[model samples]
Target: MGKVTGFMEFERLKEASEAPESRVKHYKEFVVTLTDSEAKIQGARCMDCGIPFCNNGCPVNNIIPDFNDLVYRQDWQNALETLHSTNNFPEFTGRICPAPCEAACTLGINEDPVGIKSIEHAIIDKGWANGWVVPKPAAQKTGKKVAVVGSGPAGLAAAQQLARVGHDVTVFEKNDRIGGLLRYGIPDFKMEKTHIDRRVEQMQAEGVTFKAGVFVGEKLVEGGITNLAKESISPKELMAQFDAVVLTGGSEVPRDLPVPGRQLKGVHFAMDFLPLQNRVNAGDKLKDQILATKKNVLVIGGGDTGSDCVGTSNRHGAKQVVQIELMPQPPEHENKPLVWPYWPMKMRTSSSHEEGVERDWAVTTKEFIDDGKGNVRAAKCAKVEWVKDEATGQMKMQEVAGSEFEIPADLVLFAMGFTNPAKSILDAFGVEKDNRGNAKATTDGEGCYRTNVDKVFAAGDMRRGQSLVVWAIREGRQAAREVDQYLMGATVLPR
Candidate 1:
């Protein structure tokens, strides 16, 4: 807890970013940080509530009140340790997480919550500057092996936890870099890759081995499985080689639109377009890169993925940008009395939305129009409305008659989110899938985080369906505890 009367005396404050006009010119991170003193006042705003819901709100269960109190007491080092005790990668989450912890703060029920995110950012930065963050290698090796497939937050968290517990951990990634989606999907303007680089260094020093460009599933190439270098390990081989395997590979298969002209040259998946631009920004040479420069860009889907597309398009100097959503828009502000202390259903404007873009809701795509030579030129869409049944209390989406309209579109990016993890790898391992097509695993009931296969585990989007990075990190840490307990009969890793 923080100062007893601090909540009434101080107001919440957070870091500000550079102007959108300036930030759009390059891919560099533009968010400014709060000075040490400014961060202290923000931290002091935390009320000494008997029960702190912010901890539960945080997927990784970060000790929010303790850090807030430490910062208030001017003890930055203790704050950093308390922050890191639960979250393995505060730097990553501090930048990208939506900060639901703040929303759930006890003070937030009546007033603004303590600036937990900004304080977290400050503490970690201070820790790095003061050389407080260092690799803590295990005193002795456990001799057990853990093979973590994927290098995203989940895999990285699990690997770090297991490695710190003295297990031999190897992280596999298909991409050339170690941080899977973190290195590719997220734009550098949000979080600089240097944060990930240092974490990789720390993990390596802690005895965790990271092998990039190693796809961990059976795939055919020019010759055959023989031509497949050991770089590509089969699921069966992984099961045999490692004492335990954790599938942290994200739900990567994008939800597709099969309307006519979807195969047009200008139409592409958000992952395809977004990752290529990120690669180019990181000094990678590409044969032909995806560009929105001077093009009319249309982004389908109205989630964070769509927001990211808008931001990227503005950076590309798009002539015009349009973001379309299928659902009808909610109220600008939610009914707080009805949905207090919970994530409310309301419209959210992202930093990407602050950049130039036209946002529309209740819009349905009918077809993608094309030029003679297979290039997408426009899209036909219709308006929709929600109709509720009186007897059944069921709601159904209905299209407005004769409301079809055409919108210009040189490029279209599908960001409708993922339906499930890729089926091939899960199938190879004979992992059971839920009705939602995500890997089936129990949580907290019995045998939590355990896949049907023996000595195998699953977490992140692969296990729980597409979710926030915070949720993935939470699962990764929890999965590590389960794996540890299975191997050693108990574990100290926090759940």
Candidate 2:
């Protein structure tokens, strides 16, 4: 540890952010990275805990203490190396990851956990500013080819690893741009697109080929899932061309609310609404963009996606924004003794929620009211309570009597999370799926991440269902190693 007693001396400090009122006026990142001194102070707070539960707590198993010590000692280059060793995209995770590692910090048992995410943000940003982040092209080229489908964190990580190992890697993306969900699903204010663009340039320099607007499947299928793919390659053709294929597409099938007015003009899935704004931000003009401007927006779902909707709507100059969740509200604070060293269920207020939103819990939408012109007018909702069923030993939701209510909503967005990947894409590759509709693949033992289909492997949200970007990167790295092993009889790449 750089400072043995520093944890006891310093209080946790959060990164600075623009005020909610001012930040809402534009679609740009408002959260600023910690200054070098601030980050060093944060790193000093890392105690010499014997176990380092934060390591296992992080999905990618980042060497937290080493990086913290390096940063504390002002070894910026070494800290960046330590960070890049575990995470391919710290910028993404630093901005978006919920920091489960912080929850598992030893100091968090009583005091505030170290500001690890902020320190990571500072390290990566500094790395880029100093040109420390650059292409590490393979020393020699391997006479092998690999195909990575999807360009999100998982696919990008896999492609980078394989390319660095001297294999020819080509990433296929259905969208016109690289980055799957990261390109369109997320709002610009949360994370700017320039981060993804620079990485793409670095990857290209590292001997990785990116084929955007190219879909590898039988045919393109679009049913709310955004597809700007101009060309489609058959699965057989892709299999014949590449030595191995990695499926890292996101879980794009959003869970739907099939109320009476689901067919209304103004009611849309969050995916359909979010991507357009991102495209618009990228200077792509659309004839019919879904706008929350002057509309009373109602976002249904309590997760991160719903919070993003609230933020985007506020930026769109929405009249009013309301968010409702079916589940009961969690406690404002979790019992540390009961759920230490693990993620706990507690109330979370996102920057979007702080911007402006009428948030409610224990409420379920019964129906979407129809405007006279076939547009959505409002939503009929009801308060509900969760009760345990003794016979089934499971919790069941019960609506409260006479607790029905109505919320005015000219625009309604369903941000309930995704269920699974596009079934057609998996079926095209002849890959089997689990009961949850995710690609069926185990993460342990011999030939891990290999799908039932020969020469095909699955990882990230495609195999694990919807999860954090860190988990996606971890799976991608592991899957790439497995694929390399399958190709070369053995692999030196890290698992």
RMSD per model, one decimal? 2.5, 0.9
What candidate 2 gets wrong by more than 4 Å, as runs, is 222-225
Task: Report, for every candidate in turn, its global Cα lDDT versus the true structure.
Answer: 0.88, 0.94
Instruction: Give the residue spans of candidate 1 off by over 4 A.
Output: 220-230
Model 2 per-residue lDDT at 154: 98
Q: Positional deviation of 58 in candidate 1, in angstroms?
A: 1.1
Top TM-score: which candidate number?
2
Q: For candidate 2, lDDT tens digit of each residue in 1-495?
A: 989999999999999999999999999999999988999999999999999999999999999999999999999999999999999999999999999999999999999999999999999999999999999999999889999999999999999999999999999999999999999988999899999999999999999999998888898655344899888999999999989999999999999999788898889899989999999999998888999999999999999999999999999999999999999999999999999999999999999999999999999899988879898899999999999999999999999999999999999999999999989999998899999999999999997999999999999999999999999999999999999999999899998
* Per-structure clash totals for the candidates: 0, 0
lDDT comparing candidate 1 with the true structure: 0.88
Superposed on all Cα atoms, model 1 deviates from the true structure by an RMSD in Å of 2.5
Best by lDDT: 2
Q: On a 0 to 1 TM-score scale, where does candidate 1 land against the true structure?
A: 0.96
